[model samples]
Target: MASITASYPWTTAPLIAGAPMRLISGPSLVHAISAAGGIGFLAAGTDVSTLSENLSAFKSLLSTSPIPGAPSDVLPIGVGFILWGADLKLAVKALSELPEPPAAVWLFAPSSSEELGSWANGIRSATKNKSKIWVQASCVADAIEAIKVANPDVFVIQGADAGGHGRYASAGLISLVPELIDAVREYYGNLNGGGDTSSFPSPPKFVAAGGIADERGVNAILALGADGAALGTRFLAAEEAVIRKGYQDAVLKAEDGGNNTIRTDVYDKLRGTIGWPEGYGGRGVINLSYVDAIKGVSFEENEKLYKVAEGAGDKGWEEGNARMTTYAGTAVGLVKKVAKAGDIVRELRGQRI
Candidate 1:
């Protein structure tokens, strides 16, 4: 099996990725990262209503600012989809019509491998194998399951500290990433029939996601046997990200994530954005909403207050009294300021492991 870097030949070694953050990572951010020798994924999360338009925007940018190793037949970028709510038919049709399909497709939060398999099959057929499959696994079990079902080209081992929706009670990457790597090697190593190596699908490359903010974090994941590092929270500070200025300010102001951030469904409940799978919750900076919830505030009262905060606009995220959700990973403290997405990618890339 080739390293994850081998599959993404366009990328510089020590592959850095801007995670496909829903409503945040947009065409410009994705293009910037890809243009800077890293891969970025545009968020399609739960809704591809604007998928075609977004793809067109990305293509437009590519024409004006083309990057190295960009194949004429495929766009050197990726699109992320949250499978639990995404319309599979719409996704397939959107990609099928693209003049140059995205180079990769990231699938996350599927209800089951069966559901993931269906999407994978549809996507491969739509892109005609031009796009590679990237499956996000929250634990070792999900890795084994994806290998059996989707046979993903890349395994994104998402740790507990990741921002946004993720499995609850998951381990940090320090333990999770290496464990998954060992499990994958064992699964494939046992199937190597006298080194013939063709009896089963090639082993997938590992990309560690969660609590990674800088080159040191990237180096740590690389040293753990992962082929790549994918960043979500750090990119929230990127100038090209489609994020509210107030929200971005909150991200810059937060610190001591292990103490300030938490994983819970309170944000989802108050925001009225429920429908995640059972074991999933989001990590975000602690705010009045979380504090009130912890103090046994009734759901009715909390929702009412959240509605008022919603009307407050950007003031909702003021540092002294934050009310809105600031979804981010633990390493958010390391993200000190805003920079261009391309500069952020170039700055975050670490030495090849």
Candidate 2:
């Protein structure tokens, strides 16, 4: 078995500091993860303005969260994007505008290996800084292809149980992670520099994703040969996650029956994100609208109800109807309280399971 260790300069044992205990992977969550010594990523694919503001917000938070006795140069956050819909130009613009570059850039929902290759090349050619490239993979083949083409610093294997827009045929992390590690090690040969394809002097770090909500999940992944775990659904329950309070409550309320989290094709079709692969799907709670729409009630036919449920119009925030079928994962059961990011990371690190 390979001994695991923290790869980057950042501390690893102290996970989750001031983490936003909500479902959204926003700035607070990012900073909390970084503060706790776990790498956090800012998902900035929503819009250009929001993305810019978020980056600025992250910087401000980092500046404020610095340890009193620690070094002044400590930065505790990274950034990521949905590879398929990523606005590379905008990302570049954000990076250039920022006082400093992110520690890493996570890429998910990639359209193809070629696109990842291009992205890696662009990132390599453009920046002289030390920002690592992290990519998410849904398949063994995808993982291998990405590692070879992009040579990402880290590869996150998002399993089927993951929330948000992951692959439809997503395998569980247990099966996929070790396979990916073995494949990587095989492809790269011995990281000790004896094998034929050993480009680097050491093995690249691999992070596990999906269903990783607590310490048992963390320890399991570590035992499975992963360097660490990338938690999403669990962190959504954190207090600082930028999501609706109602949604957070829903996650907490439904914790007992966490199996209610379902993977379906309805949202993708409704949201017009049909560009995804054929077998790919998403996971979320089955809501009234979702159940109602399937019974021969089309979006056009139920536009008003859908709008009402989705909180239509200008004062929609007041209506509070956008709770049904929101993205989540099976790990939602483990999330009982909306703790800070730092606390969650600490719990996971101290977890013996």
Candidate 3:
């Protein structure tokens, strides 16, 4: 395994990442994380139609609030896309036109390795090979295939405990991280002198994601051979996160670590996001909506309930309405309060709590 700084020679900041959370991780959150010496990715998975508007917001924020220790001209942030749902050509074109161009492009859940490769090629061409490509893999098979085919610069190994959409068959971080590291090492070793293992190409850097909430989790993954740590749920409660008050409150109130969250497609169905690629399901806090769905509530009925609850706005949170989808990870118990994105980054990096 290589150090994140070694793999990404652009910055020497600590290897912590604010995992892209659709509709929640906006420019404000991304900038805050980057300013705190951790890498951040703007979530572009929700609306490609708003690509121009989003880029404008990012540019405005970059100019107004520059990263403290980094150069003011360049935005040390990246953009993430759900490969299966994104318009690859349009996304690449929009990102390439940016004045600074995103430092990287993170892709996940492609329909096929061929599609992933095509997107990688398109992004490299558009950015003149300046933007690093990071791919998320949930299992060893996918990791090996990604390394052999797409050849991304970084691979984020997501465990089953992840908050959002993830492979249905994924393993936990404890077992998955080391397994991936050894698999990649063996793959490279095999390519060099059959078994000598003396000389081999540098394998893609590894980052662990899913269920990692605090500094202890970060240290544990690093000890298991991950070059960095990518946090999603931990940042969902960040003050800059553009999430609903109910969602933030849900995370803070959660007490049942892994038991409270379940991997299911009920919420996706209710929200009409059932088109996600096969073999993927989102892990989120169980609520009345999920329970009702499991008990035979129709999708149309659930959608109606969700709309009414959404219309209630902040009052719904006060009423403890169960219509909302509170996406969270097993580490929800560790997120006790909402803080600034920078402070969250610093705390997770063991700088402060």
Candidate 4:
């Protein structure tokens, strides 16, 4: 498989990417990562109404200082969508009409491969294939289906340790990354055309996500055969990240992830954001809300309390007692302090580059 730089010729080596966190990954954060030689995705999760405005803001930032090697025909940043809830019509209009659409589009959480295919096809059509497709796969079946159907330019393998949203039935990166890679290779090696790959579809680059915060994590995934690494929780600690101070502090204070964090639908249910597919769940540092759920607290009561917490503003995110949804991965513990988004990308890329 080709490396990320092989696909996006403008990016730096040992490629790092920022995961699209809704309301958190805004224009400033996206621009910072791209400026630091890593690509960042603006979270257009379910709403495309503001996408054009956001893209315009990014362009405004670039006007003062342009990234070297970035193509004039396409913006260096990416945009992400949660297919199940996204309005497809608006999405197409934004990409098709926005001057110099983003160079990449990261798609996630489609109900089926057909849905994924439709999105991939629509995006390619709208961008005239100038934008590359990046599909996030949480399991082997999803990866294989994405390959056979969408043939995306990049396959983001998200493991169970991921924050925000991920498959409830999933393995960690140690097992999932290599298995998906092998599956892709096997699929290609067994094509009926008899040792002829000249006509075979090219495999997408593999980028591992989940529980990765530093150089050691990057080295581990590269050893497992990933082209690069993408981080969600680590970036949540970035100064550019549009997160509340209390939520950011919670991430910094979290430790011993195995003991302090959990993956469950309780957080979603309490927050009244509940329409995920059957096998998906969110991981976050355990708090009173989850602890009460474990102790037989009714959903009605928990949700009632959550409403009060919502009005608490930043105070709602207090450690050990937070009722606010602090969506984060198990690697929340590894993120010790808040730094500039560009600096976070540079630190993760490290001296090895």
lDDT of each: 0.89, 0.67, 0.82, 0.86
Lowest summed lDDT window (length 10), candidate 1: 191-200
lDDT of model number 1: 0.89
lDDT of 1 by residue, 298-340 (tens): 9999888888877888998985557889999999899899988
User: Who is ahead in lDDT, 2 or 3?
Assistant: 3
lDDT of 2 by residue, 77-170 (tens): 5577765666677767667665556666777766777888877766554444456677788788888788778887777777888876677776
- By TM-score, the candidates rank as 1, 4, 3, 2
Report how far off residue 209 is in candidate 2 (Å): 0.5
lDDT of 3 by residue, 1-353 (tens): 35676534434335888898998888888888887778888898845667667768977886797665554334587788888888987887786786566777888889899888888888888777777789999999998888776788889999998998998999999999999888877887777756745355556788899989988999999888898899999998899999988778888888787888899888798777946888989888888788778888887887788888878876544435867888888898899989998888888778855
- Residue 107 lDDT (model 3): 88
lDDT leader: 1
lDDT (C-alpha) at residue 143 in model 4: 85
Q: Against the hidden reference, what TM-scores do the models get?
A: 0.96, 0.85, 0.93, 0.96
| Local distance difference test, candidate 2 | 0.67
